[model samples]
Target chain A: MATTRKSARTTPAAERPHPDATRRSQRSRQAIYAAALALVGEVGYPKTTIEGIAARAGVGKQTIYRWWSSKAEVLLEAFLDLGEQAVHAQGQEAPYAIPDTGDIAADLKAVLRATVDQLYDPRFEAPSRALAAEGLVNEQLGREFVAKLLEPSLQLHVDRLRAAQAAGQVRPEIDPRIALELFVSPLAQRWLQHTAPVSYAYTDTLVDYALHGLAPR
Target chain B: MATTRKSARTTPAAERPHPDATRRSQRSRQAIYAAALALVGEVGYPKTTIEGIAARAGVGKQTIYRWWSSKAEVLLEAFLDLGEQAVHAQGQEAPYAIPDTGDIAADLKAVLRATVDQLYDPRFEAPSRALAAEGLVNEQLGREFVAKLLEPSLQLHVDRLRAAQAAGQVRPEIDPRIALELFVSPLAQRWLQHTAPVSYAYTDTLVDYALHGLAPR
Candidate 1:
């Protein structure tokens, strides 16, 4: 159910009527994000609530209500914020677009190795899995997550592959979108299904195999 | 949470005392399988219960208790039965072995196409997704399903790739186990995550990309 219960405000916070960057508001926003993420990780998506987040964040319920539209929206933005923090921790800029070193194989392999690390990172693992598990059954949320969170990252690979195609490192005929899945999906399945362990070595091999045909040249 | 409450009647049901092939027993078995699949598909894995399946199947709880120890076990067997039925309907032998058409690409492509069909099959899709989603968050059950259900199917791919290697169609150095994922996991991610549509063409493209590699030869 969409949480439209909040009485129509004189102004919706989504319009960002005021500059939202004040130190106090920033602290509260960070706390809310942390609270929402930790709650979802611990209790899962369905059990988590705005009350829980507000209490955990040491903020009033109205504060959260004023900032976000719904719990799902809160979590989605929280994950986005978390991803940004991770990229920052890596000393990278926002978006953390996949590298295009012009050595296509090395660039792809490097990014995938980083992905292996991210997939195993404890801070993100439980909540990401929880979100993913929910997404499997919840089609609308699944598609939203894919569109907002996943597809953007996937598109970076598409851009890298298109450059590779132009450089003649990749076949012009190959579809970059589908080609990226060759490596990405293997790591994803292994992580998602507990089918196997993921590692730099495994991802390195995937890049190798994806670029070089499995058959003897 | 393993169920060990059922008193062993000095004969484990796995060692069926009766042939269990009699028309009446077969009918009851089919009904039980149907009930288990239907219940889990509707209510999901955690909420599905032995009592529910038995009641729905028109069998006593003791009848179910006699056969399987837990709802998980019952659902597992029902899926296995369903898979077997699918194979039988294909006019194939018990294992639903991938074709060894002497052309590795054609054989792998053919198998993947069948897999795409199976992924889209309404009978398998919802229940499998439910079990799989649960498996993501439930480590023990996830590992159990992978070991028992998933690994066996993957081993078949390993076998096919091995034969292709023996014929020099695949590189001997290639590990068939990881090699198979190059095609299989893409289809799986698309189906599981709702990231994209599953079709014979998509699967066919996966097979081609996997075998030929994305790089120019």
Candidate 2:
């Protein structure tokens, strides 16, 4: 029975399940994601366990173990799915890509304004802060969060800046990697530490200061 | 007896005891500071208690209570003293001001480089990360850390930038509050998130990119 169950779990798409089976699988995945996020937000990362997630999702422990290895793995993928859903809800084309509308400053400001909304969203804030707080003390988890979540988002900016360089909007000699941080890091600092409230106006000012220099033009 | 003990605890400096009593007081203070840092580093902020700190310091619980009302108060003053000790160890003037050599860019880079050293210091890293991790989850503590610890350090940069504005080294139109973040926030992000390695060269690049437009001259 165990052998048969393991085989069923790893079955390929080409082997084709019934329509009912596919629908059930999709529903289970969604339930698991929702349970993981809600549990983490409520109890924080340290207390959140696979058992709790399974219980909350009304799935067997083997069901989660068959899909993912650890709680961190589940949460990471859940956040990625959350970002995709947020983008889809916004009707954005190419959900993860930064926009390049010829004017680098204006484009960057628009995306940062969108980020302000996401950061302040009640659905996103609690779970994100819980995970972020864990990441601060857990080096292994912190590195994973940076690698899977943050670096990809930052790369979008890097790619946009590189394109700006090619179009003569940015200096050819400037390092796109470092240049992106001038605006990106300040907003990140505000969100992570709650040093100050973030706003469309504040991010707009960051882009202006970053592009035009803080000294005389 | 209770009144006598309380009076002894609150004795004014003019009515203080002899030299041996003063030396013993200093020793107890140092032990308490060391114990607070170690306990926070080991068990993290939430689990660390005033009782644990007193036990670890080999002092009576009342000794700690006599000096500080709570663990947060003890840790805050301990961290403040730690910063002062670091500055003194660096052989700089007391209250370690940011240098002003007329070149705003160079001065900012120099100070950030010193900060990079301090952030990576072994003695500072574990306890600081523990407190910071707690701050992310505890809103009240988070605000207190920002207002008491972070804002004071940031205000020094504001003062330096305002001086630069007066000297015509920086654009008068730029808000010194926001302008300082260009150099400061990147280093902060790198440390807090371990997003990247920070060094003198990296900070120097930030100052140059911040002061000169990323577009061609």
Candidate 3:
């Protein structure tokens, strides 16, 4: 993965000054992103340095510093890029937005199921675990990752819930921020802490329980 | 805290014919626990050594090896002892049991609120964070801690939920294990990641949402 990224970075520089240069830059950027993710997964966050990432990507240290200020910044962007790639690989639109087919529960369940697949994917699992483990010990880095990489995704759910509320599907009194966690955090805890296996069925059940109270109706 | 625990440990020995024997033994044990918690919290799990702990405790290396086989065992027991002391200090029964007030929601909210207090308490915060952070990276220690410290407490919630189920309060089909996470994981995430502020209101909302569901009835 790192070698592929490094070679890809140089491809654009070899090309001419027109649209091909732009394409090469795009390819190099993607390569850097992939290298960052792969290296972090292999070495973990603390041991993953910009110098190592540059060495792995076959780029100068200046290339990484020019793009990202720190290792955390690189990883966050790398994760964001990975999410986009995952969406693209799924044959969805480039910047994957949650679909609202006028069925809020169905939309939420579908997204969570997709998330389970992403979490379980071998390519994403190890690096994400490393970054998450570091986040547990490093408060500032944890908060930054949550704000940049996590909160954006969570806000998408919040937006969906708000739309549900407007349609009279969700309770007006519900705090969508916390409401999203009803399903999200359970899956997150299971994945991060090795507390349980995450599956479409488990997340589906979570959505059902969150949408319908655990208590008898 | 170490002084108190050490004094308690030596009380039996002090009662012996040798008047100073009890005080000496108590001091040693207290020093060991304090040293263990501090070392683990400061340097983290893999780096913490029994010899290091003994040296810090002002005891011979054999002292720790005599009681515990590894640093993991010593740290685990130290945490258990700390929890017991925390509960005792709160005037609660040692090995604290969650209250059963028949109203499942109220009981759950109360317990979660107490948990919020404990998670934020300065004495418990740093050391627990250090261990939990290590658990994220070390699967063996993570599972052991979960089984020994977390699961027992989680089971009490399960037992309470079962009672609620029998009382026609909770839905009969609900799995208490997963159901518990709706309330528990949110707080755990906030504490673990510093994603958000945890409070009585937050926990109360979680209980209400977990019981009542987010959708309009």
Return the top candidate by TM-score.
2
> Candidate 2, which segments miss by more than 4 Å at Cα?
A1-15, B1-15
Q: Name model 3 segments beyond 4 Å from true.
A: A1-24, B1-26
Q: What is the TM-score of chain B alone in each candidate?
A: 0.89, 0.91, 0.86
lDDT tens readout by residue for model 1, B49-154: 8899889999899988877798888888898899898888888975758889889999998888888878778989889998998999899999999998899999
**Which DockQ values do the candidates obtain, in the order shown?**
0.76, 0.75, 0.74
Residue B198, candidate 2: how far off, in angstroms? 1.2
RMSD to the true structure for each prediction, in A, is: 5.4, 3.9, 5.6
- The residue pairs that clash in candidate 1, if any, are none
lDDT of 3 by residue, B1-217 (tens): 4666567755775463464765876778778988988987787766788889998999998877867788888888888888888888888863567777789989998899889988888767877888888787678988899889888888988988999999999999999999999999999998998888888999999999999999987
Predicted candidate 1 versus true structure: per-residue lDDT over A1-217, tens digit per residue: 1343344344377753355556788899999998988888898887889999999999999999988888888989998998898888888874668887789999998899888888788889988998999899888998999999998899999999999999999999998899999999999999999998887889999999999978888
Index of the highest-lDDT prediction: 2
**Candidate ranking (lDDT, best to worst):** 2, 1, 3
> Which has the higher DockQ value, candidate number 1 or candidate number 3?
1
Q: Candidate 3 chain B: minimum summed lDDT over ten consecutive residues — where?
A: B13-22
